[model samples]
Target: MGALMLKEIRSFLNSITGYLVIVVYLLINSFLLWMFPGVFNILEGSYASIDSLFLVSPWVFMFLIPAITMRMFADEKKAGTMELLLTRPVTDMQIVLSKFSAGFILVLFSILPTLIYYVSVYQLGNPVGNIDNGGAFGSYIGLLFLGASYVSIGVFASSLTENQIVAFLIGVFLCLFMYIGFEQMSELNLFGNADLFILSMGISEHYTSMSRGVLDSRDMLYFISLIVFFSLATRLVIQSRKW
Candidate 1:
């Protein structure tokens, strides 16, 4: 698993596509957090917190992750390497997991540099180090989990088809639905308690909750379940190819 993960990481680092994705992800994040003259811009806000940037990131990630993961499994299958890969000693689950982790870690690295924003905000506050360190830390955790959820969803989508475009579209749709669709659906009161159940299952709820500096075990468990469910589903999809 470690070797496979390393191979994935090396491949990503060596590829132009990977570099482009990382650059765009970080660039857009910078714009939203520092440059753009909007809510995310600290200059115009009541308090120059990084909260607006964190709040808007989910939407950006909805597109960015799929663009990054579109080639993970889909390109492998398209190039006919998947069959040879399946013949290797690794299990389907290992392949899925290693690829997922590689993609996830790459994104993590992109996010790490954004900590400069936190530091800058800390320094700029009324008193040096006056920022909500706890909330900022919790928000970073929330972002990681949210990005991990996207990675899982992207992996599952990639496993569904050999066409990267198809994978990308499937990933975007599922990501959107998981992140926000359920929450919106619940507001219609169509399912009553059922709506509540579905709403609670959405990623945005837990993500937003965590971003607010309150880390609930319920939210943590939800993200964990989401990652496990999608990883296993991807493995199952690959395993079925033998039939």
Candidate 2:
């Protein structure tokens, strides 16, 4: 499993695609946080916070993660190597997890460079570190879990198709739906007082809750459930080939 995971990670880093994804993610965020003169600019905000980053990154990952995981299983199937892979000693669960972990770690790497934004904000704070450390920390944690959820979703989407493009589109749709579709549904008033409950089912609700640095166990559980659900779903998708 570890070898397979490493192979996926290496395949990413060895190709221009991996570097391109990281560069694009950082460049967009850096522009919004530092260069662009707007509400998202750190200089324009009154408070010392990378809130703009937390706000913008989810949107970026909505596309970026799909690109990262699009080829995970799709390429294997396209090359007719999935049969060879399945014949290996690993279980379907391990294969799915290895790909998911590699994709998720890449997401983490993409986010790591953004810590420079945090350092910059910390120094620029009026009292030289007067920023809301708790909230900032919480938001970062929330972002990791959010990215993990996306990766799991992407991995499952990849298993659904042999064409990487289809997988990418499907992954993006799933990520976007989980991120905001539920919130929109709740706004329609279809559920009455249950509207809030419906809204809570989306990723945004739990992500926002954790962004406050509250670290609610329920929010963590929701993210874990999402990751688990998709991981298992991917495994099932792979196993279906046996029948």
Highest TM-score against the true fold, candidate: 2
Top-lDDT candidate index: 2
Write one digit per residue (lDDT tens) for candidate 2, span 36-142: 99989999998888999989989999999999999999999999999999999998999999999999999999999999999999999999998999999999999
What's the TM-score of every candidate structure?
0.97, 0.98
Candidate 1: C-alpha RMSD to true structure equals 1.1
Per-residue lDDT, model 2, residue 214, is 76
- The TM-score of candidate 1 is 0.97
Clash pairs detected, candidate 2: none
Question: Candidate 2: which stretches are off by over 4 Å?
Answer: none
Report model 2's TM-score to 2 decimal places. 0.98
Which tens-of-lDDT digit does each residue in 7-65 have in candidate 1?
A: 88898889898888878877887887678888678767777588976887899889989
